[model samples]
Target: MSFDQLASELVSRKRADLYRERRVLESPQQPEVVVDGKAYLAFCSNDYLGLANHPDLIRAFQQAADEYGVGGGASHLVSGHSFHHHALEEELADFTGRPRALLFSNGYMANMGTVNALVGKQDAVFEDRLNHASLLDAGLLSGARFQRYLHNSPESLAQKLEKTEARRKLVVTDGVFSMDGDVADMPAICHTAKVNDAWVMVDDAHGFGCIGATGAGVAEHYGLSVDDLPVLMGTLGKAFGTSGAFVAGSETLIETLIQQARTYIYTTSMPPAVAAATRASLKLVIAEQWRRELLKSLIQRFRDGCQQLGLTLMDSPTPIQPILIGDSAKAMTMSAALREQGIFITAIRPPTVPQGSARLRVTLSAAHSEAQVDRLLDALERVK
Candidate 1:
């Protein structure tokens, strides 16, 4: 019963290669950040809208902290839910054009809580093979019969659904694939779900404030309504540039989660100051549409540059652009070379991505300049 040998065994097996060792970040989340006391142009953050360091958000957080105390102190079902949280939920519901919305401490909890609450032991849950780990984990924990369809293949989902004999079926997928940088085929999936009498859910964590007109996310991009894909989950920490997550859906869905979602009912609510900051982030995401435009231009610029270099890149129309390097060690080597050039793009290896398809997840932000993109391209060419 010696537990101390486990670390040695992992290191010996080289499975420790999959470990992510975070660098010490010494500044706010901006286009440029100091890591390990070295300045670098960071391309690894989910802050697509660049509002993380906005002056207005900081001021709102400061002001809210002065009014509301720092800690939430209790769970939402108790006395933790504050006016800030309530206002943000209302704003989110309105933003997503849903009847109601409920907030969770983070996107992981939001996905887990919603899926586990909606599907029971006897139900069937079908997910994309490449869906986020949180969604897959929730499906397993829900005691439902879990199945995975081929990535982005509606036909595969239909086949799986046709075989399942459960009375209730749910199909969930990531609106924007995180590591691949590609979007889910929402229209096809929704159509398949409708034809199969299955409910569809979209975790639009990367799309909420970065895709579609007014940043309404993937469903809106595909012109799907609440009736088409009823369960929508988005994270405020991504494009919103704050912390926390929300599920936007029909009134019944929200009320049911409030009552049955163990993660939502048991965990202490997020700080009101974070909610206040998220309110500011939401405002900036909507009013400052120029940010999204700038982000798009940067993405296009990088894509065009990568194409010119003949580098292997994914076909993605969002800010989460990935450069596919097939070998895990090769991807890590490329990432390290870029880091030496003061460019921070993290290497995503298995089991986050497929074994042979590890990549450098080069995410873009509105705060980054065209010159910076060009510099990244130049550095990439040198490394290539």
Candidate 2:
């Protein structure tokens, strides 16, 4: 708790090779980026659809800014809500096939607020072991009896659910595991939760705008309806290539959050221009099916090339492909070696991932060409 203890802990992290730092990105999120005066073929961005710097989105943002100014200026309940924000929420609700939707400043606040609003001391919350940090923290902050099931194990979840005697039960999981890049077995989880009379919540932050026919995310990918996955959370920042988050569900569910979610009620709303830009991005996400196709092709190409080189990869059909290197030091060394070859891939170490499972988190974007992917494969071949 003391400053001296914090310094000692920082030193310990540095010694263990578990310390994390940020790279100064000199350019926008793209396949090729300038970092600290050096250019690199980057594979670490989450702009899966390559819409982060899209001209249309920029234009939409600019137009909205010209009309509405730069800031929300207040929280949603305090007159910060604009026509742009309302329209975006309506569009999201329609796109997700939900009756209503509510926007939050970011995904972290959305997750925290949603979970906290739904459960309390007399309730029980069960989460997958690999759920996002925000989900875990929300569960703890809810004052619920929180328990974690084995990762992606429906049977484990069922066993835990059967034992909970709380007044309300909530089962939460990430639709796509961020570090592992594997989709959750939502059908099984939903079935188990349904039988146990527990509500299911999915934070499909990474899955949205990258999965499904119209990029409706994991629920749509699995053909799940609103009844099956009642509480759904998606972020605009990742594949949508904007900056905000939303929870889409029943009208009652949204109204309940509007009344009870502290994070949404207390924090200032996101910029109206961001909402306008996201509206533009959402249109592209729905109409431009080719972006998703290109991303899938890139993912397959990268996986095939890595397999041919005998590099270990996680079971991921998505854009996030992690090359497993057991030791943290080895992962860092491989990342540095790739950087020397003008490739920019980040080494993900504990406690992001489990101990002894440090990896190079190589992400793919639609903006990257096949030749660029080949270049990355070639660099990875050398580094590995």
User: All candidates' TM-scores?
Assistant: 0.98, 0.99
Q: lDDT of candidate 1 vs native?
A: 0.92
Assess the local accuracy of residue 309 in candidate 1 as a C-alpha lDDT between 0 and 100: 97
Best by lDDT: 2
lDDT of 2 by residue, 229-297 (tens): 999999999999999899999989999999999999999999999999999999999999999999999
Cα error, residue 207 of model 2, in Å, equals 0.5
For model 1 the local lDDT of residue 89 reads: 96
lDDT of all the models against the reference?
Answer: 0.92, 0.95
State, as a TM-score between 0 and 1, how close model 1 is to the true structure.
Answer: 0.98
Question: Per-residue alpha-carbon lDDT of model 1 for 333-370, expressed as tens digits?
Answer: 89999999999999998888887888899999999999
lDDT of 2: 0.95
User: Which window of 10 residues has the lowest lDDT sum in candidate 1?
Assistant: 12-21
Flag regions of model 1 displaced more than 4 Å. Answer: 13-16
